[model samples]
Target chain A: MRELLERKLVFVTGKGGVGKSTIAASLALLAAQQGKRTLVGEIDAKGNLADFFETGPTAFKERELAPNLWGMSMDTEESLKEYLSLQLKIPLLAKVGVLARTFDFVANAAPGVKEILTVGKFLWEVREGHYDLVVVDAVASGHITGQLAAPQAIQELVQVGMVRDQTDWMIEILGDHDQTGAVIVAAPEEMPVNETLELAARLREETVVELAAVVANRVLPELFGRGEEEVFEALAADDRTPSPADLLGAAVGGPVRPILDGAQLAVTLRRTRGVHLARLRDELPTGTPLLYVPYLFQRSHGARATRQVAEHLAEELGY
Target chain B: MAARQRTASAGSVEQLLAAKEIVIHCGSGGVGKTTTAAAVAAMAAVHLGGKVLVLTVDPAKRLANALGLEAFGNVETQVPRQAFLDAGAEPRGELWAAMLDTKESWDDLVRRHAPDAGTRDAILANPLYKNITGRFVQSHDYIAMERLYEIHASGRFDLIVVDTPPTRNAIDFLEAPERMADFFSSRLLRWLTVPARSRVLSMASKPFYSVADRILGSKFLEDIAEFFLLFQTMYKGFVIRAEAVARTLADHRTTFVVVSTLESAPVREAEFFIDALDDRGLHLGAVVLNKVLPPWFLDEGTTATAKAMVADAVSLAKVLPEELGSPDQVGRVLREVGESFLNFQVVANREAEMRAELSAAPEVVASVPYFDHDITDLAGLLQLGEQIWR
Candidate 1:
């Protein structure tokens, strides 16, 4: 908690199916619980954060999801509207609206402008100082590099204007090592690990933002001692043992042996996951913390699941 | 016409593969595109009796799992071929699958397509080219398309099924090869080259020029200059190649099957992709809606009543939401629950409507229902095949 509070903005990104929104929400909840005003922002155009908050998609504007915890799923055009109205002092529905729409159309037509606007909105919120911490649930690792570099990319393309000024300010905020931190979330798989390392390297090269941590989600918990492998083998080989089919009767209980066999399978899965974690740690830049999240059987979508993930993160962050 | 042969609800994908050399599957993320693509390729190999290769740009391991392979690198592996043999089939057709690695594939393409050894090395070593090809745009889809083109040209398979990247990137990738070829031939590139050469030619600061020369070799710069010197010739060849690919993609021998789940976003994405294909003169062969929720289940109240009377109450918490107590809260919960059910029904109904709309244009081959387990392995894939093939 102390470490997380030390940074102004926290960027959490991971592979697509790795529960990034869950982690970001949990972090926001943790921060708010510590009495810090925290905001969890999601830039996914699909508006998933509201769903995570048990709200409708229409409930996307800034709203208090929990005590001291605000949530907003960014709509690029809406954010642009808000930015123009508030920051630029443009009228809400004036001629500027038409111009803003035109700008949005042009930006949307450009390759990476949506990403730029999304990230730019985060930068805008950080500058407002309305929250003690801002946790951005960024896109998947595959597109995150472009998302992070978007301000600079757009700044280079559009020179000598208010847009450039905003981009410059964003670049400064993002490039400040003490102000921002980036966490790469991944699963214990070859492709995700490879992409995580690549993302870490890019962040190190392009920005001063600290590559603070890597959260490896859905890791199978290691159970049983090394010798349990042989024990399981011996159990399977026992000649006098009743067949699993015999044990499947009402008297013996339903599917106990199959569940036990599944536990045995889990052991191998855990071992494989551990090996990948070790390899990722070895390959990652030294001093970058690696956090492993055990796979919970339940779906990690609601408040209960977010709390569970927060507990894991709390332990990892040494809160 | 190609449109005449396609079915609105084409019963099976078998006919679609008959004449098509390539089938591109496009959909939103989490829609089982990988599984559907794998199933189509598997069907081609096992049922259609044609050699097939499934190419995927999904960073997820779904493709490898669907094919029952332990892992898939950039290179094609021969696992499905073995699966067919094990199924008591003759294995007359071979199945191969590969995961696209964008940067590596880009490097390979540059090396293969460059005019000369000097130009190849120059482009490989140029930081600008490296940035442009490697990290400039979303490279996953572009590389996937390039790999598809390579596989098509190799003549190793009679049919190729490409599981496209998610919607946005897939669109970008489909257009990238032509875009990149055009950029290589554009006047803007010619303008950037003059500045690139000045650092090499200017002898006023010999040491700085030498350093620049070393980084981008003087000889390499000269070759790049010469290559662009004959830019028209190179551009003509690239345009010709692109045209050939475009024509091949539009031919009756190719099909575009848009995969979606029986969900709102996916259906919308599929509709958009179908329209885009039509606008581009591409033909739609099938629409495979996967992982659809079952239309009906045993009523919970009846099951609860039975269990309660028998002195063994069945736990409904796992299968049903908990009673939230207050009527309003329950109403809210029900409303939320109702929305999901409504959305599912809406998607299913809309799919039927879409099929009817597309009936005049092409056949709707199959609609796969949602399964209890994740489609993560060959066994699951075989299960998927059973559902679709019938």
Candidate 2:
């Protein structure tokens, strides 16, 4: 985490529903705790991350969400306007109403043009060095690869000029081992874990971006020991009806069988989660560090849960 | 098939599969939307006796694995009848699946709409076109919509199930055709077509050109000009296709099914998307809440009794570990189990609340519990379909 904070930019990506936004928010919070000025960039227009802090929708402009943390939701249109002005050096184009039309044309003419602008916004911020740490809560799994690859793709196709120069700089920042790193966030589930491994392999092969670590989110705690399994089985299999002695210390009325069944269910879940976590550890690149975040059973994923995860992250990463 | 009576609640998957020609699965990512789509398509083809084509617009190859097939290309491949039979489902109709090749679809569009072969090849060979079409942001969604229109027009299958990319991307998928139409007809596109006018304007804006040329190079600018020049004659074709797609999407037989999990975020997104569909006047058929934790069997009173019994066991275990041979360990395990059960109850209550909230608005809500294993095979999908349709 300290190394990640020292870098100018860090990207958190994973399969959707693996809590990327929450993890990204936590990383940003962790960075802020270390006295680094951090900007968390979310590409989601719906502003899911803003909800984590109970902040209103994150605007395109950065807002101070915490002491040293700022948040902004990337608007591709705004980014495109900025990119146009920067690349074309035509300040007039920024003011003209035609910019929106041109955006539409570019967006329609080229499928990935808007994506480049969005990614370029983060790279531009990283280059400016305003914030000590920049965290991009990138779009879901495969799209993250596309987002990271956009500048390079444009450079490859364009061959020369402002786009190429801009992408070259972006690539350098991303490719520099010490400057930028990508961390994958995933749940302790088969698909998310599989997708994370796939993304890691592709990230290694396709881009020069450094793979920082894998944050396995929602991992369950192992409660049963080897010796205890037999005891639990004996207890669970003892289906004999509870007598008055069993009910003597009871707090309420009804069958104890449901409780035993429920316990068995818990044991099943714990073992299942354990299996998935082991698989995740085994399948991820050997040297890549894996951090575990306990499954949050809270009613709502609010600030406290994020903070809890962040504290765990700080500890695990030795921050 | 019987004429199913329309009810206040969203109809079952069987009804939707039998009735609607187009069923689109839209949701936030990683809620098993793709798996659900594949399962529904499989169910429709194998059990319901309807020829179904499942179109995956996502870049991932998840749908193929979910349906127990090898990776499929842009062209539809029939799922071997033997696989369905092996899964114990006798099919009267065929199951076909395909992955959308964005570039190929765009190429097909060019082939269909370009004024001539020369113009088509010119646009196709343009490095700008090749790069953008293959990697552009909404190109996947736009080309996906175009492909949907093309296949639906062909009448290839009785039912077409589309697994959309994800939330906002799904919105883009829904709106792509109209946006593409607007782009083709926009004044800016017209302005770009007239090379002489662009040249005159560039001459007037000499400083901008000098900087742009120095940065982007003269060849890049020339490519841009030539690309636009080549596309100038194809705008009408683009608009016509877009219009045709828009009509296809709005067709009466088409329906959108928003899939989500029991979690707060996905539920919120699902409601928002349903409202967005309402705003667009698109018909929403159902909301499939995937991976919902099943309700606890023990009622509140029974749960209290169970809790008390477990507590009694823990107390006994702690006091008599030596006599009971690891009673303390037993207590610890029971305590953890009790805690887990309580947590499960909490989550189950939350799911119920979410379902009730969604149900209050009068949408068909089908809740499927979290399967113990990943649904990556035909048998798993069939079981999932049973749960959903049941």
Candidate 3:
């Protein structure tokens, strides 16, 4: 996992709501804590990392969120402008009213253009060698694959020019096993884990990127052991109510009903979660390390909590 | 309990289903949007007695599995009647499921909108068309919505539940028609097509063509010229259909149901969507907060009793070996369960607070407690439906 972190560019993606953004933030924080300058690029204009960092929404330009951690929210429109002006050498085309009007049409006509621009910009950071690591909080699995495969796809279509030359560089960096890798985030549940495996297969087939690590979020703790399982089964078979004689023998006090119900719910939830965990382990490719992050029951994932997650990952990853 | 009361009154998901013809479930990924859509479709068919079609543009196949469909296709397929019955649903109306095939839909749209067979065939065979239709950013979203409008107009299903892709793509699904309209009306295509229209215009645009050919290759310019001419002939119909789709989306019967979770990121994404939908004047009726932790039984009156039980249970566990099992194991299990109940309360309260804050928004927010397992079967979906309507 640490070796996975050593890649110059780490693209993080998974099924939505699996805490991909949080995992990216945690990984970035951990890398930074290891004395590496890390830049985490968020794909949407709305910055989720801002909340995790407990800062204002990340600006379009990169800004330091922590000592060695920097964050930037990638707006496709802004990236298009930047790409046109800087990479394509058409500084005024992206600004002119008429051409800008055409920009939308062109962008729509070429779907991966925006994706290419976003990914190109991220790869550009890696090319600049300004940071030790570039972590991208990517879009959901299917689209993220499109983004990762964009350079090669476009290169195959376009035969010549600066765009081709630039994509060549992207292909080189992305295909370099030691330089680029992707970390997939998944929950312990079935669909997310299944999607994670699917994404891994797609990445292996379509892109030149490596499947680095799988981070399973919200893994519930074990609440029942072998003996306890038998005990719970026996309890379930018996009537829930205690006999009058038994109540008198114990001389117990307080409201027992709620506690008993809570215990039952807890045991059921834990037992079910264990099944999912087992499936995840069984389905995942053998020898591919899967890191489990315990469920953190909190109201908000503010900077403090994000750092706490980072600490947990750091410990598990042996950073 | 108080929070649940407010959410129940803010807007009933059941009422939203009964009232609306189209229920669009838009949210970020992994928030149970697919499950919510499937459950809503099932509920509408069984409880509301309306024929329903649930379409998912998400590339993931979870919806098919969630609906317990043995097979799913680009075309709508009826969910097995036996599965619905097994789930204890008295489904009076039909439930159909489909996954979007962007390429197929794009091809169909071009064929329908084209002026003639030759033009349509030419457009279909164009390499640029193939690449653009398949790779374009909003093409998938746009085509899904186009197909949706077509299906809705056919009057086959009384209710259409859409489980959209991730946030950006879902937003694109809403705005795609407008983008299509803009593209059809843009000046660049008109200029590009001028060379193919008239010999005089071709001569007049020779310098422009020469420059473009020099930069992009003569073959590329020829391909563009051919594509533009074919596209120009069909532009009117395309614009009209795009505008019609936009109008259909804004229809009062069309309601956007945002599915989110208690996480700040998802909640924030939901807020962004709600605000965007409001700006567009689209009706937003319900916000489904999926996988919320259930509240504990402890409240002000019960807290003292719960604490007393914890103490009593711990003491009784220490002496339980004499009566039942090993004292150490019994004591450990009792203490862990007792302490874990408190932890559950804390998690539940935090989630409740977040739900309360979100409920203050204009849309009705309904919550479904985090299930013990993934809801990938019809019975599980029915269970979620009951919770949503509960």
What lDDT score goes with residue B41 in model 1?
77
Q: In candidate 3, how many Å is residue B230 off?
A: 3.0
Tell me the TM-score of each prediction against the true structure: 0.62, 0.90, 0.89
Against the hidden true structure, what lDDT does model 2 obtain? 0.76
Classify candidate 3 by CAPRI docking class: acceptable
lDDT, residue A158, model 2: 70
Give per-residue CA lDDT, model 1, range B1-390, as digits (tens). Answer: 122444335545676677789998877665667778887777677767667788877755645765667788788887755665555455557788887777788778766667788767766675435434444444555567667877888898888888887634335655766765665666545543554456443343453234324322454444444445433335555566665666677778888887776444455556667777788787887777675544332233322332332232122111222321333332232232223233333334444554444334446556686553445556567668666664
Q: Mind sharing the TM-score for model 1?
A: 0.62
The digit string of per-residue lDDT tens for model 3 on B1-390 reads: 234445334557777778889888888777888788888888888888767998887655666776777668789999988889888877988899988888888898988999999999999998788777877657777887898899999898899998875646447779989988887787776776665665465565565455444333445445556776777788899899999999999999999988888777777678778888989999988888988865554364445544554566556655433434565555555555566667677677776666776666554667798786667788888888888874
**Residue B188 miss distance in model 3 (angstroms):** 4.6
For model 1, residues A159-200, the per-residue Cα lDDT tens digits are 444555567688888887677889888877655676788889
lDDT of 2 at B111: 88
For model 1, the stretches where C-alpha displacement exceeds 4 angstroms are A58-60, A86-93, A109-113, A155-159, A223-257, B1-21, B26-51, B58-157, B167-390
Predictions in order: lDDT:
0.63, 0.76, 0.76
- Model 3 Cα displacement at A88 (Å)? 6.3
